[model samples]
Target: MSAHSVPAPLPCPAAIRLHCAGPLEAVVVAALQRACFPEDPWDDASVATLTAPPTGFAVIALDGQEQPVGFAMARVTAEDAEILAIGVLPQARRGGIGRCLVEAVAAGSHGRGATALFLEVAEDNQEAWTLYKVCGFFSVGRRPGYYRRRDGRVAALVLRRNLDGA
Candidate 1:
């Protein structure tokens, strides 16, 4: 494949499995976060804190081999839920892992009585933006200089998806 070309999606994308993650899996989730976001990795303790029970929850995506490949963390407050973070390992990208994780988080949020799910993506992240758009998310707001990059800072586009039908 060309350097800029993405690999074709896995033939059996369904092989990817998803499971709810709790404090017990915080270490695994932290490792995935670090692998996916080397520039800003969260430690195990922080992951546990963010994905604590009640208002917060997290999902872990496992490959067919049952190896953790991705994770998504979210929190629900009242009728609103926000995705705090999500990541799929670089080696596992373009294979529907990210989409699966997003769907899992949305479903979990809805199960928690959330009417809407929200997430923020860096404006320059075209791949993630497209994924969210395809997942029924729409831009609702923007925060300037929200994401710190090696070059500088990038604006964050806040996107929301209604979970009323979820």
Candidate 2:
């Protein structure tokens, strides 16, 4: 995609707004992140710290009412980028918000000179795994017991995709 090209919108039942979150939206994005990943959410301080770095950026998805329903954050360095976190509220699941957020990241990363993007997802998160696959990411590695949970440790699958034509 060209540096100024608009990110493609995901097909879904409801309309969703996607935008790059700035320093002013840090607190709101942190709250949305916590709502989506209650198991291990980043604190407001962490969100502020991550989003302020030169290499870091955030994408937030909002519903019709302008409420945050999902968010994705990533860091890019030179020709590579890594998705740090992405989450959609339970109420917004399967509505295409998550996919849109991912696309936003991919487009933004491509614009920043990143040739590829990587992300690690909990092994048991079938929905997310499927989403990534549909979005062109392929599994490249796995880390055992990477996520600590109340029941037991869950593995994390690393996925990567080239953004040559994103």
Per-candidate clashes come to 0, 1
lDDT tens digits, residues 42-73, model 1?
Answer: 99999999999898888887788988888889
Tell me the TM-score of model 1. Answer: 0.90
Evaluate residue 124 in candidate 2 and report its C-alpha lDDT on the 0 to 100 scale: 97
- Distance (Å) between predicted and true CA of 103, model 1? 0.9
RMSD of 2: 3.1
Instruction: Write model 2 residue lDDT over 31-70, tens digit each, in one string.
Output: 9888887888788888877877578888887788877788
lDDT score, residue 94, model 1? 93
For every candidate structure, what is the RMSD over all alpha carbons to the true structure, in angstroms?
Answer: 7.3, 3.1
Task: Return the TM-score for each candidate structure.
Answer: 0.90, 0.90
State the lDDT at 15 in candidate 2.
Answer: 66
**Which run of 10 residues does model 1 get worst, by summed lDDT?**
3-12
Off by over 4 Å in 1: 1-12
C-alpha lDDT score of every prediction, in listed order: 0.86, 0.84
